[model samples]
Target: MTTGPSGSVLVLTNPDDVTTDLVLRILAERRVPVVRLDPGTDLHAGAALTAAYGTGGQRGTLRTASRELDLTLVRSVWTRRPSPFDGPPELDGQERRFAASQALWGVGGILASLSGAHYVNHPWNNRAAEYKPAQLATARHSGLSVPDTLITNDPRQAREFAALHAGAVVYKPLWNTPYAVDGRAQQVWVREVRPHEITAAVAACPHLFQATVEKAFDVRLTAVGNRLSAARIDSPDLDWRQRQSLMECTPIAVPDPVARAVCAYLTAFRLTFGAFDFAVTPAGDWYFLECNPNGQWAWQPGPITESIAHAIADQLQKGPEL
Candidate 1:
C-alpha cells in the first residue's frame, strides 16, 4: 500500500461509472498510479453469511477485507461511489436490516482506523456543502451576490413569496434524488414559478423558492485547490439541462472578486474541489446558487475535464501548495 516514488491514489468507487473511468484515464495519462476498489468489497465481513443475486445490476456478497489493504498506506482516496447491497428475499425485513447495520458498522470501524489522508472532497464535506441555504449564505458572506430565497413547508407562505417576487421565482430540489420507476426519466426544471402552483408543490417537502434572476447566461465554476475555471453556459431554455444540445460553453475569465470568494468558500468547507453554479444576470451581476463538492466535471465541455484532472494531480504530487 506504500506509495512509490510516484505518489499513489486509491479511487474507491463502483466499477460501472463514467466518473471512475474518466478519472482513471486522466491519472494514467499523468503517470499517477491509482488502484480502484469497491468500498463494499473492501469492507466485507468474513464470518458473516451472505448471498449473491442478480447478474449485473447489483450483487450481494459475503467476503472479507485482506490485511494488506489496510488504510494506513492510503495517501489519498477519492470517495467516488459506493455500491448498493440487496440481501436475500428469504430473509425477513428485520433480518435484512440487522445484516445491513452490521455491514455499515464494520465499514465505520475500518474508517476509524485510518490516519487522515487527503480526500479530494471528503463525503462529510460534500454533505455539508449540499445544503443550498448554507451555500447561499456562505457566498454572500464571502462578497458574492445571492438571490433572495425562501424555504418553507407552508403553501401559503410560498405563494406569498412568489407573488412578492412578481412570479419570478424558481424551484429546485434541495438534494439530488432523481428516480425513475421505469425506463423514462422524470423531468425537473428550474423556471419562473407560478403563485398558483405553490399549493401542490408544498405536498412534496419544504420547497426552496427563490427569486429567479433574469439571466443573460449561466456559469459553472469548477474549483480545484486555489485554481478555478469558469465556463459560460448559454441555453435556449430556462433550465440548462433541458436544452443541453443547444447549449454552448466556453472558457471565461472569472472576476477577481468572484475567484477570491470561491477560494474562501472552499477553505470554509475544507474541500479541495467544488463545482459552483451561478446565475449571471443581464445586469452583469453573478449570483451564487449552490456548490456541489462531489460534482460531475468529466462531462463538462472541452478542456474543463482535462484541466480539473491536471489540477487534482498537481495537488497530490506537489503537496497542496496550489
Candidate 2:
C-alpha cells in the first residue's frame, strides 16, 4: 500500500487484532495512507516519535518499522484496544514504573494531540462510557428502556433488590477483568442470582444486579458514525457468549424508535462507534443492556461484519465532518 497525498489514518491496535486487519485491507484498497502502531509493545522496540509545539500548534513525525507518519497529516485515529506500555526488561522496580509512566504521558499524549485528526471514539470518551451507572442513566435519558438496576456494596440492598424482582435478578460484573482459578482462566458470566446468594462478602465491592428481562432473543447493534447494523442472536444460555457454538445470528432491521434512541445514546457519549447489546422481550420490547464503546463486531455473521468494516473504512477515509 502507498500513502496518499491527503492524510493518513492512524490505527492504534495490536497486530493480532483481526477486526483492524479487515478495516486496514479496505483502506489499502482505497489507496489511503495508513499508519498502524501498537504503543505498548512498539515504543522502544521499533517505533519512535518526535513532536514539537509552537504558535502553529503541535507537529511531529512517528516512525514505525515500516512507515513514517506525519502527525499533522493524520486525518483520523482509531483508538482500538492497544496493549499497555511496557518498559525494557532490563529495568525493574521503580525504574520500570518511571519509564512506563513517562512513555504513556509522552508518546500517548503526543498522538492524542494531533490537531485536525478525528478519533473514531476518543480514549477519554471510551473510559467515561465504560461506567455501567453512567450507561444506564444515559440510556434512560436517551429514551431507551432500561431494566430496574442497582449498583451497591451493601448486602441488604442487594437482597432487597433481588427480592423485589422475585429472585429473577441477574448478577453482572461491573467490569470484565481477567480471573483464574487453579491455573485456569475463567470469566464471570451473567447468571440468575437468588437473595440467599447476597452475602456480606458483597460488601467487599460494588456489584450490579438487575431484574432479568424475559427475552425472546438478544440483539447486537453495532453503530459506526450514522450507520447501524443490527444482528439478532438466539441462544439458550443466559449469556450468549457462553455458548457460541449453539448460538445463531441473523440480520434484523432496527425499529425506528430504537434507532433514534441509539443515535441519541451515541451522541450522549460523543462516540463515533459502539457495540450495543439489547434484550428483546416476548412482547417485542427492546431493553437496553449495555454498550461497549470499543467492542468487538467482527465476530458477527459475515454480512454484518463486512458491512461494519466497510462503514468504518468509509469514515476513516472521509475523516470527520467539519
Candidate 3:
C-alpha cells in the first residue's frame, strides 16, 4: 500500500490517544509519510518562528540582505487531539511560555499556514456539531424519527410537557459537565420525570425534557467517511453509560435509509466522522437522539476500529471520494 503522490501528513495529537495510534498504524502500514506532533517539549516555539517570523517574515528579503535560510512548504496538516502541557507546576516558566506561545504561534500559527488539510473533524465544525437542538432539527430534516422534545425554563410549560408524555418523560442535561469531588465519577443520567419533578427540573436550567421511548435497544452508529458501523447496545437501564456491566454491545448493519440519514447528518455538520446515539422501539422504530462529532469510538470492537482507521487513512491518502 504505497501512496503514489500524496505528500506527508502531519497529525497534530497527543502520543497517548489510542485513536492517534490507530491512525499512525494505518498510515505506516500504507507507507504514507506521517509526521507526529506529540506532547511535551516538542511543542516549543522555534522552527516555525525561525521561518515564518525570523528575518522579519521575508525569505526573499533575507536573501537580498545576504542572510542564509531555507524555505520549505507544508503540504497538509491534520489537527487531531492537540497535546498541551499537563500540570502547570510540572512545567517550568519557560516551558509554560512555550506552551502559551505554541497556542498562538505553534498550534495556531501552523494551522493558519496550511492552505488545506483533510480535517477528519475541524474544530469549528465540532463546535457546530455540539449543538444538540441543531442536530435534532437536522436529523428530523433527514427523515429520521425524533422524540417530541420541549426545552424551556418555565415551570408551567415543563409540567405540561411531563403531563403530555404521561410521566414517561426523561430529563437530560444539554451537556455533560462531570466533576470529581473525591475519586468517584458521578454521572448524570436522564431519569424518568414525574409531574411533580418538573417544577424543580425547570428551575435547574432550561430543561430539555423528552418523551422517554420504550427502547428495544440503544444503537450507537459510528460513521467514518462513507463507512458506517452500527452497534446494538442492550441494557436494562435508561442510560447505558451509568451501568456498563449490564450492557451488551454487538456490531450490526444499519438499514439503508438509516445509514443515509447518518451520512446526511454528518454532512450537515461538516464532519468526517460522528458517533450517533439512537433509540429503537419494539416496533423497530429508530429515533434520533444526538450525534457527537468527537465521540469516543476506540472502546468499540476490533472490526469497527479497523474500519474507522481505514476510512480515516483512505480519506487522508486519497481524498473525500474514499
Candidate 4:
C-alpha cells in the first residue's frame, strides 16, 4: 500500500451532504490534506482499513479509491451523518445482518479510537447528546431556561400535565425516525395538545410534552469551537421548520448569558460543536429548546453560512495539540 500524508483530516459523512461539501471546499483552498470517507458505503466499495495495537500503541491505515490515510497521523475527525453499513447484495438477510454488525463494531470502533484526533463532537458523544431528556436537564443545569416539560407513558400523567398547563402544551416526538404515510414521507412536527386528546394509546410509549412558550422569534445558534453564529428565524407556523420557505432568517447576536450557557452545555457533553435552538420571548428571555450535536449549518442564509463553514474548517485544520 502507498503511504498517505501525515496530519490528514478524516471526514465521515455521506456523499450528498452539502454541509460537508462547503467545509471540504474551504479545506481544499487552505491546502489541508482531507480524506473524506463514508464508512457505511465505502467500506464495501473499495475502501479498506487495517489497525493493530500492542505495547507500541495503535497503528493503522485506511485506503479509499483516490486517497490513502495514515490513521495514526490523522489530525481530526468529523463524525457527520454517515450512512449505515451494508453487506454485498448477494448476501442473505441473516448474513447481511452479521456483516453489518461486524463492520459497525470493527470499523466504527477503530475510527472512534483514533489517537490524538480532534473530534468535532465525537460519535459517542453525539449519541449521548441525542437524548432529549438529557438535553433538557443539561440545559437547565447550565443555567439556560428550558420550558416546563414532561415525559411519560402513563395516560393519567399525560392528561394531568396538559391540564396543569391549561392545555397550552405542545407534543413533540421523543426522537425523530424515518416515518412515512402511504409512501409519502411524513414528519412529526410540534403541535398543540389538549387534555381531552390524551388517550390510552399514549400508554403505549413515552411522550414528550412541553408548555408552549410565548415567543417573538426563534434562534439557531451554530457553535464551532469557541465561535458562535446565530440567526433569528421568524415564521407564522408554530414550528419554523414546517414553513421554512415562509420564514425569514437574519443574523443575530447571541446574548452573553445564552452564549455562556451554550458553551457550558457543549462542555457538559464533551462536544466541540453543537447547533442550538432557542425560543426567544418578547421580554428577551431565551428558552432552550434542543441542541443537535451534528446539526446542519450550511443552510443558514447570508454570511452566517460561510462564517460557520470557515470556523469548522479552522478547527479541523488545527486539530488537537499533541
Candidate 5:
C-alpha cells in the first residue's frame, strides 16, 4: 500500500480506548491521516502484514478492513494496549502457542523497527522503566525526593527494615499482576504493614517495603513531549487508588525543581511521555513514587485532556527531537 505523504499518525490501539479516540478526533480536525490498528487481534483475524529489513531499507504495510497503512509514511506510533492475540481456532494448544509467539516476534518486531516513527514511549524504554527499584534510584539521583525503599526476599531483613522505619513502613507489590479473588478482579494497593505482618509468605517472592510518605495529597503528573500536566488528587484512603470515588482532581502548577526533576527523570528513561505519581506532604514537599512510562491520562479532568491531545499531535507533526 502506497500512502500519499510521509506524514501520518499510526495509532496502535483499539476502539474501546477513549484516550486514543480523543486524540484521533483531534488529529482528524487538523486533517491528519491516521491508521488505527489493534495488532494482536488483527494479526490473527484478516489483517495482512508485510515487513522487511535489509541493507536496502526497512519498510512494511498493515492492512485491515478496506484500508492499508504504509509503514514508511508513519510519523508517530502510539503504543497503547490492544486486545491480546487469539490465533486461529483450528490450531491445537501447542500449535496455537507456537504461532502466537512467532507472530508476536515477527510482526511485533516490524512495528518496533519503525525507527523513524517516534514512539510516545518506546517499547524498550517501557520495559526498562518497569523496574521500580531502578526508577526510585534514578529519581533520587536526578534530584527528586524519593521515599526510603527496600526490596527483600528474606523474611528477617523485611522485619528489620520495618523496625528501622519505626514500623512506619508500607508494603507494595513489586509487580502489579492482575489477580482475581472470588471471581472478581483484584488490584494490589499500597498499604501500611506491621513488623509482625511480615512473615514467611514474603519469602515466597521478592516484596517491596518502603517508608510511607506523609501524604497531604497525591499528585499525578502526565508529561507529553516537554509538556507537563499536573493534577492534585485528594483522597480519604491510605491508598488513594482504592478510594478513587472519594478523590478530587484539580490542575495545579508543578514546582520548578520538581518540574525539572520530572523532565530529568523522563530524559533518564528516554521516554517522550510518562505519568509520574508523587506523594505531597503537609510541608509542601514532593516525593516521587514511580513513573509509568506509558501511563493513562484520559481520565484526568480539566484542561489536561485537551492540552495533552494537542501536545501529542504537535509532537507527531514536528517529529522526534532525537
Candidate 6:
C-alpha cells in the first residue's frame, strides 16, 4: 500500500454502534477526518472497492454511496461488529454462499491488511483472541493464572471432570456468538454446572468445562495501547454481562504484575485494545478469565467511558504507540 495524508481514521462497523459513535464524537471535536464503512452491506450494494498490488503491498480505495475513502491515507482503523455479508434477496442459496465468500475474503482481506494503518485490535488479532482455548493458553503463557479448563466431547469424561472439581465447574461457550433458536435469539451464559447436567448430548459437540472461580468481585480492565484502566465490578450473578443492571463498577488500580501481563497478552496477540475479565478473590488473587480484544466499553458503570473514548480517539489520531 502507498502512504499519503495522516489523521484520516477509518471506522469499520455496523450501524447504531454506540462505541463507534463515542469515538466519532471525540474525533469530531478534534477535527480529525474520518470515514465509516460497512462492507457487508456496501460491497453487495452500489459501493465499489478496488485494491492493487505494487512492489511492497496493496493500495486500494473504497467508495460508499456518500463518500470515497483512500485506503492508503487511513492512519488508523477501528473495527467493530460488522454484520455478515448477505447477498441480494433474489440470489439463490449457492449463489449467496459464493458472494459471501468473495466479499469476506476479497474486500475484507484488503481491509484487514491496510498498509501503515494502526488498528485498535486488528481483525486478524481479534479472530485469534476470540478463541477461548487460545485465550487461556496465551494468558497462561503470559504468567497469568487461568482457571483449569477442559474442552471435551465425551459425556463420561465431562462428568468425571466436573466431579473432580468438586462439582464447582462452570459451563462456558468456546465462542459466544448468538444464534436464533425457533426464531428467538439465544445465547449461552456462563453458569455453574453439576455432574448430572453433562448428558449424552455432550457427545455431539465440544463443550467448555472449567473449574469455577469463587470471587468477591469481577474486574474489567480495558487496555488501550499502554494505558490500562480497570473497573472493579460487583455483581450477584455468575456472569456480570447477563446481570448488568444488578452490577456496580468502580475504577480501581490494577496490580503491577497483572497489568504487565495484560500488556504482554496484547503484544502476544498483536492487539492494540483489549477488554480483560478477571475474577478477584478476597485473598487478593486475580484470576484471568478471558480477554476480548474488541470488547464493549461504552456501557461502563463508571466514568471509564469517557476515558476509553479519549484513549481510542488518541490512539486512532496519533497512530498506535510503539
Q: Which TM-score value belongs to model 1?
A: 0.82
Cα TM-score per model: 0.82, 0.96, 0.81, 0.96, 0.94, 0.93
Please write out the lDDT profile of model 6 over residues 183-255, one tens digit for every residue: 9998789999999988999998899999998799999999998888889999989999897899988989999
Write one digit per residue (lDDT tens) for candidate 1, span 1-322: 1223333566666767676676577567667766666655444434232332355532222233432333444557676766644333456798877766665565533432334457776767777888888888888888888888999988888999999998768998777677676877676677677898777659668788899888899999999888898889988887887878889898888989899999999999888999999989888789998888877787676588788877776555443222
Q: Model 4 lDDT vs. the true structure? A: 0.90
Clashes of each: 0, 0, 0, 0, 0, 1
Tens digit of per-residue lDDT, candidate 3, span 189-295: 87888888665546667778898887899999988877898888998889988887889888987988898888888888888878899999999889999898878
What range of 10 consecutive residues in model 3 has the weakest lDDT sum?
60-69
Between candidates 3 and 6, the one scoring higher on lDDT is 6
Please give the distance, in angstroms, between residue 126's alpha carbon in candidate 1 and its true position after superposition: 1.1
Task: Kindly report which residue pairs in candidate 6 clash with one another.
Answer: 1-58
Worst 10 residues of 4 by lDDT: 1-10
Sequence-dependent TM-score of model 4: 0.96
Better of 2 and 3 by TM-score: 2
Candidate 3 has what TM-score? 0.81
Give all candidates' CA lDDT scores: 0.72, 0.91, 0.72, 0.90, 0.83, 0.86
lDDT of 2 by residue, 1-322 (tens): 2232388999999888988999999989888888888887888687788999889877799898888888888999999989887776679999988998998898788877788788988888998999999999999999999999999999999999999997769999999999999999999999999999889999999999999999999999999987999999999999999989999999999999999999999999999999999999999999999999999999999999999999888878887667
Off by over 4 Å in 2: 1-5
Candidate 3's error at 38, in angstroms? Answer: 4.7
Clashes of 1: 0
